[model samples]
Target: MVPLLVPLLLAATPPAPATPAPPRLDDAVPDTFSGVERVVAVGDVHGDVDALKEVLRLAGLLDDKGHWSGGKAHLVQTGDIPDRGEKTREAFELLMRLEGEAQAAGGRVHALLGNHEVMNMLGDLRYVSPGELASFADQATGPETSGSPRGFDGHRAAYGPTGRYGQWLRRHPAVVRIDDTLFVHGGVSPEVPAKTLAELNRWVRQDLFPGNPPGGAANPQGPLWFRGYALGEEQGAGLALDEVLKRFGAKRMVMGHTTDRDGKVRTRFGGKAVFIDTGLSTGYGRHLAALELRGGKVTALYREGRVELVTPVPPPLPIAPKQTVPRGQVSP
Candidate 1:
């Protein structure tokens, strides 16, 4: 009876989570950047083009005319830019244009993949708005066709693998490491198989296409859907969170899937993880904010003022050398 009870208890207990090693680096991969002086990250547009614009301006990344003005600084949009609101098309167009402009200006734009993007690719139109569908109508169809939303075919084509937006989005990454910080649409979890950044990106790209069979990498526990850092207790998940960051050689992780109720950028686990999804779309909360990382410090930028989240500790001053008196020189 005692032996049988021990076996049952072992079966009921869950296996310990797997810890991942640091990912291999590839010079050809664009998912990582270092030595960047400044990085501004925003989250979850939900097709609110105006809200997107407001946050860009707030971060000083965009000009009044919507041109890229961040100079050499990098701008990271942690995904969920489509659905809910009506201006997804315009939002994509703006991002596409800014990508080239920022590159020309010696800067970069990293638009990561969110769960919503994969949903759209998988034909999950649950959150897509009617106005969003109408926004894709061909110009030649005129106003009458636009009112009736005759662009379902066009909308489908545009999001198809061969379409403009689809092709562009497929080439974008799911996670990026800039300096010592990691950015992704959702938080990374330790429950899944250990994977390098390149492997993660390749898997996401493969699953986005129509013909490929799903490998379950896009499941709820994957990088694009995990909400542990945002909703889970640090005392329970803090050790696992440290392992996730270590796997990527990152000091911290910044994500934007789960929206905070107060619409402010919040940190967990002594600022090891940050949540930037302020629900910028009017549908969720109309609040606006962006995360700014510069000069070894982290700040949350809002319309009202900036709040410092992490500040660099100054290095200790070198000790002064003591002088030895010569044997003959003595007392004076």
Candidate 2:
């Protein structure tokens, strides 16, 4: 009674109501930049600097310096921003710059996170030797063979290092949800909700990246790189479109991890999961592939010539020399 005597004359003013939690990413971010009519979704952009430049050139976004030249078109990169190529740094920088430039030009560059990005963060994939990560990496690419700034691979000396860009990409979003279409580098796990994607990003950014991985299965390693099933590969896990849709709150989905039959962008999942990885790196001398999403439909595939397909040959797993731990001697 004595402890509360001082407040007897005043009704306790309720502490200011806790501020409502900020809106979830989907609620806060516009699926589409307001007023943009169409969005261009590009496939895996491994360290193909020349190919990146060409793609941007085709979209009218880059000139000679790999700068933003697209005045009004949205550019959606379907992940694969690192590894398997040399100019990963240049490509990452150009894309980051274009993100702002595109927005300023009444357009936008949506940098969707892909599996390779995750691998790079975990030190799984290597863009170049540790010492050469900065200088020897590839720059922005478009198609076919790529070129360097001073016009030679030796110009790598002038390009500096990959540390600048590699670090920035580690925190990038693994997937970008544009309007009703989920722009992802890899396929959406059969039934992840849009909130789950946001949750994963928040967890990684806030927990996983700072020497604090929240959990293995629920961590960035799982969602960003998991492709346990194919679109119609009855042999393994089948894509559950209904569940995938429920997770993203979208009617359709567009992903670019696996490839299609003709090695060009093809629609699959009966309009549910669209496979856009046409293996552009294979150098089959075919048309570069892409997709145009409009009104919740894939609308069109942008390639039209015989192109190459990077038929992935899954690498053999490393085997211990002789099961060093000895059968059941392994620690429990």
Candidate 3:
């Protein structure tokens, strides 16, 4: 009987490991999307709604009435929609409205989280202007006194976890992959190269909630605050950049934390890194610059109909080779 049992156990196959379920589209952190004919990315509105609208119009994204006109083009706003200006509330409202409109038109509005957004969510109001605070007064009931606990308390309440904007903002990703390009508020740091996009986003989202430690989402070197790509040494930084791109399987990374020294949309690392924050906010005199990706080409679109081709960076060597997928096809 023992010999027979031994034979039966040896013949039985071991159970296969359970496969982890793919993230649901609604709850995915770094939302992976494909099949976009064009991509328009704007950086750091900083509460400057006028400049945002003008830039969108220049890119043929928004209509005269500020409606979604870019039929199937993807619109990516690289965070910092709040702070340093007075129209933060209005800026949020406009993006919120356009999000629905864009989707209905077969497009998408990917608004990645920036440091200022994280600050606001965590109760840091140093940059919250009086006008911005008053904008939400009517929506929330609170004392009207200035500098009091109740002052701007209404705004805070409206932007808290239970608030409309807060709920919407929570759903936004810290990093997103559209086609083969990566979009993030700040540059990715060395510590982040090992994590997958989904893991990176999941950690960030978890850190955003209250009572969490001050590392993942709030650290200076985190995705929302890291500037290594923008200010690092060429050779070393290029190596780090290669690792990040390889990890995410993206050809290029588009970011908006650091403004270009020349106040124009520019690329570094031979075009592996594109900086779109031309300081378009009124605080920066409304630079009115944006980055457009279409037909496998990158272009810098400026106010007054100025268009220039952005030079492409030579593909990094000895890492994962860049993969180019045809339109309407998803890359493996």
Give one digit per residue, the lDDT tens place, for model 1 in 1-332. 88899989999999999853322222134888999999999999999999999989999999999999999999999999899999888888999999999999999999888998778767788888888877776632234434445666667667776666776777788889999999998887876554677876666566775566563336888889988888888687888889888887999999999998798999988889999998898998889999999998999999999999988879999997878888889754
What TM-score against the true fold does each predicted structure earn?
0.82, 0.63, 0.82
Error of 3 at 50 (Å): 1.0
Off by over 4 Å in 3: 1-26, 142-151, 304-332
Question: Which ranges of candidate 2 are over 4 A from the true structure?
Answer: 1-35, 60-69, 126-163, 190-196, 204-208, 215-221, 228-239, 282-287, 295-332
Q: State the weakest 10-residue window (summed lDDT) of model 3.
A: 20-29
Pairs that collide in candidate 1 are none
Choose the strongest candidate by lDDT: 1
What is the C-alpha lDDT profile of model 3 across 43-104, one tens digit per residue?
Answer: 99988888888888888889999899988889999999988788888889889999999999
Looking at model 3, the pairs that clash are: 270-313
Judging by lDDT, tell me the better candidate of 2 and 3. 3
Candidate 1 ranges beyond 4 A from true positions: 1-29, 139-149, 315-332
Of 1 and 2, the candidate ahead on lDDT is 1
User: For model 3, what is the error of residue 100's alpha carbon versus the real structure, in angstroms, after optimal superposition?
Assistant: 0.9
- Candidate 1 local lDDT, residue 167: 68
Per-residue error (Å), model 1, residue 327? 33
Model 1: weakest 10-residue lDDT segment is: 20-29
Model 2 poorest ten-residue lDDT run? 151-160
